[model samples]
Target: MKEQSSRKGFAKFTTLDIVLMAMLAAANAVMTVYLSQVNQALNGLGGPIATSTITGLYMIYGLLAYYIIRKPGTALITYGIGAVVQSFMGSAYGILSCFAAAACYLIIAEAVFAAFRYKNWSLPVMMFTGGAMVPVWFFFAAQMFGYTKWGTGVLLVALCVRIMSGILLCGLLTKLLGDALSRSGLLRRFAVSRAVES
Candidate 1:
């Protein structure tokens, strides 16, 4: 009876969940490569501020997967897979940095959802989760890229921009995309589809 119950519980993550996670991770890997070039161009043009504006886009895929899956460990697992995929796909930041970035995102995302017991999928919750994920990676990036020398005021401004970008581009965009997918019936078997219907 215990073994049967364990199997039933483990069945929460179905084949579709694995496929969706893999697809999103691959997509994230591709986007990461493309965005690295964009980041370089923006950095040259308007410095950190310009590059920070698109920070949220870098984080969306994992959040979108979490939003759709509405499951514990969704962000972490997707991000881990994404890091592996990014490393193999020729990330500009190289292999270690790709995994580092994924680690930073998953840590915060997992904490936030776990705090809510992974039950709340409201817009505010999503925005908070997205915005909250920014600072840790930003700190690491600042240290790595010598952004600390840019003066405190500039660093603060860039951080703020990144947070706002996280809220809008990652959080809001995930919600919108999840709802659209749910409405189109593509996510009918996912928890998000039922949430949307209710």
Candidate 2:
């Protein structure tokens, strides 16, 4: 029963989290609407680009959710929920694209977190969690949408863009969130768990 309860908790995000994610998705819509042309232009110029890295909204969403619910399925639920919320709201991405994005995030994040047994809430692990956003970022926005279908060179460039965004923006945001959560004492047990790992 306790385990079931824990699972439920992992699957459930608070009302605050929901509101935050919805806002994020709405912003994504606005950004995409306004900046997609620039993004296309940059990709044309750079041979693949990290345009989505501009806002760093999704990174914050993932990091904040992980910070609050440091348990298995939490990352997946929050990411998936955020995508759904974004699609349901007036966000830029269509419902199909949102589904694709949510699936990529859910699968990759679960794989990484499961490998770590879902307890590595340290800075690095959290960073990796944020890093996982990269593939989905491209998978949904670029590949599924036919951007990567341009050519092999374009595909490789897209991959580079994803990695660059993950490292520079997502990773940094995750570390910042972890630090803030540590300061807030919301992640005390996670701190000890990280210490044990080291």
Candidate 3:
């Protein structure tokens, strides 16, 4: 009989990890609501780019949580918590839609991390994951807003814009934020903290 391979990396979740996940999830919810409000305010006046520019910011919490926790299921848990918080805060899309979007992001993020065996925390891999999230993001948005019939050219353009935004906001900006937090000594126990320290 073949022996079962242990999920050694996912063996446990410390109290500290749980606390950090909760805090990060709440932070993401607040930031997402605030940014969405800003986007709505400037949307029509400033053009579509105004809202799209911040699309990547939506992935920030998930990225940070994954980096800090370095464990499987972190994305799902954090994003799920954030979705609930956003719904309660009166998000324009309602609770279900918020959760749906968060789920989509989680699916993509989790798959990407799994592909790398959760070992590649390099900036390039993070950026790739960020960019990869655009397709899923666009899919849910299209369904929610009834944009499923958008022409190919238009959809392509929109996807490209989102990918660009993801790289900038989720990828580079996330790294910057992580670096700052790591430097503050708050993330000393996390793997990402060591990367920053070195």
Which model scores highest in TM-score?
1
TM-score of each: 0.93, 0.67, 0.88
Instruction: Flag regions of model 2 displaced more than 4 Å.
Output: 1-47, 50-59, 136-143, 184-198
Candidate 3 yields a Cα-based lDDT of: 0.80
Model 3 C-alpha RMSD vs. true structure (Å) is 2.6
lDDT, candidate 1, equals 0.91
For candidate 2, give the lDDT of residue 177: 62
Better of 2 and 3 by lDDT: 3
Highest lDDT against the true fold, candidate: 1
Residue 82 alpha-carbon offset, candidate 1, angstroms: 0.3
- Tens-digit lDDT track for model 2 on 1-198? 999998787556555555554554455445455555676676576545545444344445555555545555655656676676666654454678766766776677677778888666566776666666676657557645677667878676657656656655666666676567656765555533244335
Q: Pairing residues by index, what is the TM-score of model 1? A: 0.93
In candidate 2, which residue pairs clash? 29-92
Collision pairs in model 3: none
**Candidate scoring better on lDDT of 1 and 3:** 1
